[model samples]
Target: MMTYTREKNTQLLISLLKQHGVRYVVASPGNTNTAFIGSIQGDQYFTIFSAVDERSAAYMACGIAAETGETVVISCTGATASRNYLPGMTEAYYRKLPVIAVTSSQPIANIGHLSAQLLDRTVIPKDVAKLSVNLPIVKDNDDVWECEIKINQAILESCRHGGGPVHINLPTTFTKPFDVNKIQHARLINRVTIDDQFPLLEDKKVAIFIGSHKKMSKDVESLIDRFCEENNSVVFCDHTSAYKGKYRVHYSLVSGQEYNSIITERPDILIHFGEVTGDYYNLKIAAKEQVWRVSDDGEIRDSFRKLRYVFEMSLNSFFLNYVGHGTEINISYYETCKAKLDQVRNNIPEIPFSNIWAASQVSSKLPDHSVIHFGILNSLRSWNFFDIPDTVTSDSNVGGFGIDGNMSSLIGASLTNPEKLYFLVNGDLAFFYDLNVLGNRHVGANIRILLVNNGKGTEFRQYNHHANYFGEDTDKYIAAAGHFGNKSKSLVKCFVENLGFEYICASDKQEFLFQIDRFVTKNVQDRPMVFEIFTNSNDESCALEKMLSIDIDKKIVRKNKVKSVVGTSVISSVKKILGS
Candidate 1:
């Protein structure tokens, strides 16, 4: 029987308590305390010990803390029952034992009135407890956020930063039924804005999703890598996410839109941080999941609809505080998602010859430790299907995803490290849009550019583009074809050669393969390299359309065989009956 109630304030307290893994909740039963006691009695996550005497419950919590070297909770009703906790709280304060006394009280306005069972718990003896927090009745979102902060304050004071006893005065009503099955979500506000110190989190199902990000610092990358390893967590990444860490789920999640497999792998606590994602491609997996958004600004950017916690610190600091303390997950969530991806990969047929197919073939050719930047739309979306070496970090301008800055971004990344090779796999339109960067003096011999020229915005030839409905006219005005007067080699070759680059152009797969090996080699021809591979626009769109249905058709074919067998069995049975 699921017996947790719908009281907002109590829900916030319990949600946070579960998050911190507060196991034992000692309850002293009374009329005012029924709201908390009745709700918790049905939940198996908490171990409830009944001690009718309020004073006895407090002393028992102290004894439990002393013996176990763990924080223990004491729950009681309002009135003189709170006074009974003074002696035990003082002992816990002096002994530095971590004991939390949560006393349920009537509303503050009801205290001075002639209302029964009301007491002003606002002012408790300072020395009796390390700290006392009166949690308000959470009616609005603001109240809800405040309620969680106070609960966290009590939680932190009780067990962390030199352990000691703390008091929480919970104000709640007594009418709601104890019928809620799952614990409600609560906002866990961390006050450590600038400090590296983080609070320990106790949730088991932790997920870190990285959207578009800058190249992470080595220290931050190392910390993220270690945190994922220790917690057995997964980092969901795409081509634009730009995070290359261990335990990376480096699959194009946009490809999984049809399967809804992403939704199946939802986490109990999702930690998402990075810039905006290009794959709004139904990331609705996090729709109702607990998310803690980590950012420097610490502002409320609730991308995930079910955001409960906002840690206003660096991703590293937020990760450091939550990694080691409470992750004891037995199942591999990473393996679960990986297995689904592997199954889909096994069904993936020989990709049709197009920009994607060509990119896949040469993706493995990029040198180790090289930085690869992708253009927006077609280029970023296609290369995402292939795997890159972890030593290589890749990114795209998904923040304001536009074709105009792809080459410029590549040049900027190249300037970061002159000795290490920097690379770009871009579409013709994007390259031409940012063509001025090619002549820039900052272009170094270590730079490699793979311009996948589909003649125009071939993406506009596909289903999603508005121009697809405009007929052949899309070839001119929409697809923006016939650029450089459709003479691809003459214009691009002359331009690159004039810009002091080793220009290599391929019109066919065989031609591309013959030169791809040499093109990717260290400092090809000692100048900045441009390998422009030309393809038909239709081929580019068809290849993408083919990939989307690759697994869908395979699954349908398997099920159709079962249907055929069932039909044959029925026909044979009918023929036998007719003969009889």
Candidate 2:
């Protein structure tokens, strides 16, 4: 019997090709793609044609696809073989033909070494293929998931958005035997446009997750609000999501903890929108194959590794389709989430005076119509736990999620709306990296910066972080400690004051409380201010540990209550026996 190839990626490709309805394959003779070519040459599902020249084989595949309007796979070996497909691929690109060029090569590690038949095929001319993806030789589960998504993405791109040619660079070990009995059924992701029928989300535990988005229009907000009201749905947002609706819930407080009971009850379907999100902790509350991403880009972004459908449409149109449809109001899931959020919010412990505590103290007290931007990771995660006013808008440099451009972006936004207030909460590293922005002559008086200086990248020093294992040694290099004068008391004070700005330094709770109101309530006509609050890494780590473990502590308390009741029952029985 003819068995499948032992190579996992090759087996995956063969399975996907069969399932995606790719029947025509043009093969060129070579040793590098023997595992793939040998497995499919005898498969009854594929009509394989042999061509000695790779150049001719590519044009042949193109001709077959153009004639039948079906997807054609052109397979070739490593090095100069794939170079011959560019002309045909460019022709296919212009004509919008669905041709998938599968170029097999040796493991990428051999590329600059003295290995034969290995070429740098990682990059190619843009006009040749609409999408280019590289597939890893599968070794573990991560590799399997990566290979599956890449292959599915490449295959779908060929026929997506008016059809074009696509490239898949497959790295293979040349000596793998063809002895497997069956091929692994890889996951296939399907795309749905506005014209197609969307999946049924009625009465399901649905949740709409929005990342960093521009301020939504009232009409769009109303559409989403009605959708959640008609269907049992809630909007899970971080501070940057910019969604002011009735069903908004901050999932960050209950996330990233092991004992949060609500997290285990996964949503039936998660509808995702917008750009990058800094809330990596809250994105884990859905099962694989349960997410439906809605976007106009129509590209497959499997961020949670649970992408099952990509709805290609605008946000309003996507929601409007199901708002008045079969969806019924089921508030069980949303209420469950809100109750858990309230429990965590009401029982917040008296944490140390860290960045989190600072944000909690001032997040709700900011001016009603002001704008706020947080630094990436630690600063953003801190503010996400608290709620800002509906009229107060928030954003971050989370699109690139870098640490260097926080203040520069804030200064630029201040230039647009000179009358309104713009506040920035940034870590020391990010603030110092972009310190030159303060000296920009265009900076307005409406800007207020809260610089949390802990003398290091405190995120690396968190209790659960991998770098925390290094103890104080982590400060040597990993956290880049002692940089920029190591949180000098006079460093930032002098810098901001010299630039004709007001400087406020707070080293403890008492100092911060005294100066926070002055910084926030000051008129926009006043000089731009910088409030540099000094904190230590230990307090920052402790606050995050205490907040995330609240649900776990509740569980322990419940167990103790059960034990108390059992002890009372045992004591009553013993007393009754002694009296008798």
Candidate 3:
């Protein structure tokens, strides 16, 4: 009886290799890779070759793949063994051969600890591999998912884009005994190109989700609209998606709210495009069984953890292929989502004077042909709930999602079109961190900065945030309160005046409303402006709570809670106790 290795990563590698039909493997002998090489040495699914020299093994793979036109994998141990494979990889890179170098390594933590036979192989020469991924030893479920995706990516990259060489540096524990029989279940995500046959989505309930994208052109928007209408689907977007179509649904509005049982029909398949989405709450609620991502890079982006395929082609190609596929019956998913979103849009509660309140006041008041940039977290989340003018576009540094470069990115974008106005909604910590960019001489009069000076990192003080457990103690270190002169009224005014900026300050809603028109209506003739609004963390938290609990039926909520606790007989009693 042939048993696989007990090592999980080794098991996954062998299983996916068999699934991908990679039959030829040239392996060099070493103890670090014993668990992997030993498991597949006698397996009928693979034909393993032995080469004592790592360099000879790698070159042999190059020759075999070049002649057979098949993906060839070369395995070696840690230390200088992988170093010798670089020359062959560089040759394969130039010739465009389908060769995969699977180098087994010791734990990265062991490197710099005087451990023998351990080399720092974190990064290799760009010419050596088109893609290099480090596969960590699997110990938990997250590790398992990561390892599987990385291995699948490495295998797929070997034969993609006219074929090229790639590297997978696998770390091993070297102690698991060969005791398992069958490998664990792993998803084999196939890449679909324009030339290849796409999956039949004829009668399936489809939903297209777009992330943070640049202002889309008219052609792309028209294609998306036609595809949605013909396929009986809807397109979900956020403030940054830049997609203004008929079937567009700002899903963040309904997804962020608490009592969201009104819309329960999930899509059968989700087609994702664009980059990072700041609306993570909607993403969690929108997970489906099958997800097809479209990207020209051909990389596997398993964002929803249910990725079925990756369409490696232009966005236009994907929409063109599926536009004519129609469903027989009328699908109500789009209507359901729109009705739910409209419910919140029409019944928006009066929020406290915080970031959310500020966004509600300014989002609809922005001028046309302008651009707005938001800082991550509070600023991004607040603006996602409101609707801006269709003519106004928006963007954020959600790719990296850091607070450091929020304003710098806004300033950089202002230089692109000096005639158009550019607005930035930033938090106190972010504004102070990137204050140096405001002093840049290239800043134009079309730049407008709305500094929400809340005197702390209000994100940490949210009602449901983990940092709330510490209470006031959170401000000491986690929130870093009392920093930047504790929102000194004179500090920013003096600094911006020297930097040639007309400064404005507001402490209350009346003050903000009185001065907001001047900030919004100011054209290119005015000096660069900064409007700083002072708020508190309590109001911020309250505003967030109000926005999330907009349309809750107290009777139904209490009934469900009571049913889960006891029986339906006590539903009325629970509702009465809950004041409904």
Clash totals in order: 0, 0, 0
Ten-residue stretch with the least lDDT total in model 3: 324-333
For all predicted structures, in order, the TM-scores are 0.60, 0.91, 0.87
C-alpha local distance difference test of each model: 0.76, 0.87, 0.87
Across 423-444, the per-residue lDDT of candidate 3 in tens digits comes to 9999999999999999899999
RMSD in Å for model 2: 7.6
Candidate 3: where is the Cα deviation over 4 Å?
78-90, 114-120, 123-127, 175-177, 258-265, 326-331, 415-419, 436-445, 494-504, 522-528, 551-580
Q: Write the per-residue lDDT of candidate 1 for residues 356-375, one digit (tens) a residue.
A: 88777878877888788888
For 374-471, candidate 2 gives per-residue lDDT tens digits of 99999999989888888889889998888989999999998999899999999999988998989999988999999999999999999989998999
Question: How many backbone overlaps does candidate 2 show?
Answer: 0
Displacement of residue 530 (Cα, Å) in model 3 is 3.5
